[model samples]
Target: MSNSDLLDKKLCEKLAQSASLTIGHDVLITDSFGYVVASNDPDRVDSLHEASLEVIQSARKIYHDAAAARKFAGTKPGITIPIIIDSIVIGTIGITGAPHEISQYALLIQQLAQIFLDFEKRQRSTTRTDYRKKNLLREIITYDSRSHDEAAICESAYEFGIDLNAARIAVKLEEIEGRHDDASEETRVHQAKIMECLLRHFDHPQDFVCPQNNTGYVVFAFGLRSIQPQQYLEMLQQKCLCVNSECLTVGIRLRIGIGFFSHSVETLRQSYENACFALKSIHAGIRNSTCLYIGDVVLEKIAASLPDGICSEISAQMFGRVMQAKNRKEVLLTIEHWFQQRFNFVQTAQALHIHKSTLVYRFRRIRETCGLDMYDLDKVLAIYLLDIRHKLCGQSDSRTSSIVM
Candidate 1:
């Protein structure tokens, strides 16, 4: 680390104050550039001290008596000690008094300065390490490995003790009800506590946790030997519920979404994307639920992977007339409930809280207006698939209307 970064002005002032109080003499602290950064005499601050420059160059302490002090500019009767860290002189500390009276305190002041400098150095090192870890996580989830050398990625993962071949799943956590934006400092503290709890609870050497785009937390957990995805997800769900229950008392709640298992680095990215999609699928109706899995919405997840234009085309062809009707939302809901109940008229009516005859009338209107054969198995499958696509992608009203050209 550079001298300016290691021994900043605020630290220099603190050292000067402590040294002055301990030795009962005025103290002056200078940077490597020979400028006084802190001093008991306020007028000396930011001024050049030529004698301290000579001490820095010689890498040794210089003592001058009252008679010898006249030879150097900005010099007083004192002992100037070089503040050395790791065999390099970073700054100088001078105690203004007779050489015989203040010379004993010179070593004590130098040791104190070295202590703080070492601490600052270590803090910078830790910050760099954290940045590298977060950067690696971001690249693993977003970078295209095909454009880079495969061996290099493997080597990088090895350095971090991450096994690329291990079975792992991505989990995402976010605040429900859109409460993240207005978070206060106290809320951020709770957020950090929640993240720390996750890291400790997982407690696997190969597992990783990091912030995702300042929005929420993401975790990548490597499964143990012979453990299946279902077992891992079940264990994680139980842990999340326990954590959520404890957090509720503190007025913070979280929703968790889990993706499918991935055994390779390439598929890990897809798993993370699936986790994000699952989290986004949560609506107001399911707000009470704390955990969601990608497997629960397989059809919607599959439709999300298809090209948007193709999904839109399929939706327009299958439900254009019904979506364009005066009561489009109601018609869509009825169709969704009918499919969800597996074409059982009584069950569908009960689910929707409507009379059986009313459901029959609605089905007849759908068949006439949309030109869909409800009883044909192939057409029924296509319509159900399109409905899932519409629910996931939220097809616009304008696109649902037939185009006139």
Candidate 2:
């Protein structure tokens, strides 16, 4: 890259301000074209530091004493040093103070600024690579399956050194929402932080992540063949919990949906869809962070896929009286807790904070009103599916409660 390309204004501004703080003087940096690009003194920015141009031409330090400063246009009574990276002068840094007062810092400041420049160059290179990887991910995952070319996708994956042959787990993340406009600097900063945290946390060779448009990311992680799916999911669940904890420190509640492990690009797409379904399975009313496995959301996905007309017919046939019951909310809550506690009367009662007799009374009333055997597996399953449907659609009789089951 050219010397001007190395002059990142923000990086320059930050380094200038930091160095100024350390040395107790104003710092200024210029591009290769010898124009001031950043300065601790805002007024000096974009002003040509003619002395820096002299340092640039000589490729050596130039001291400007009071009389010398008067000769060069835009000169300050300090030292101007060329910032060299890889033996080439890319820019100039000028310390604004009397030459004798700050002369001791001339070499020290140039070395420090050059180090910062070298680090920034490496950082920018890494950022560009990450940007390419995310762009590739968005291309593969967001396109319609029919419209996407599998061959081209595989080729692009190979270019990025991604192994489509190895098994992988797809994860969808939703960390924040409605807090800032998607295009705002705040949103970008938060997204970058979360992505950086995830990349560090899942530092496996095969793990990759991409930020989604609005509020989240799509992550693909290497799948270990040594562990059972459930065991691996539990491990991933713990890792995601750690991520959530970190995000919470920043007031971000992270929600993640994990898909099952699978092989191949086609299966990868399916896994992505499963992750999406897992995300949808969550009740929007839940404000706390959560990480849900795809397998756990099968019933909810099935319920969600059902046509509205079918759901309506089933809802009417299954719980016509219960829907219109005077105590609809109570009955619904009771049913949900009973099923969640695995039909253990005492446990369910304890969960609901009601006496065992009172819990039985609710179940009895449910059976009578719904006109179905509450103990029957088919009847109970129907209720569960409809409950899931209601949750996914955000349809509720009262203010929606968190979907705990």
RMSD of each candidate? 5.3, 5.7
TM-score for every candidate vs. truth? Answer: 0.72, 0.72
lDDT of 1 by residue, 219-336 (tens): 8877777666678788877776776676666676777778888887788888888887777666422222577788876866665566657756765665567556776667657766
TM-score of 1: 0.72
Lowest lDDT block of 10, candidate 2: 396-405
Question: In order, how many clashes per candidate?
Answer: 0, 0
lDDT of 2 by residue, 16-60 (tens): 898899889988999887889988899988888888787888899
Worst 10 residues of 1 by lDDT: 396-405
Name model 1 segments beyond 4 Å from true: 2-4, 10-25, 30-93, 97-123, 177-191, 283-289, 307-318, 338-381, 394-405
- Report model 2's TM-score to 2 decimal places: 0.72
Please list the C-alpha lDDT of all candidates, in the order they appear. 0.74, 0.78
Model 2: C-alpha RMSD to truth? Answer: 5.7
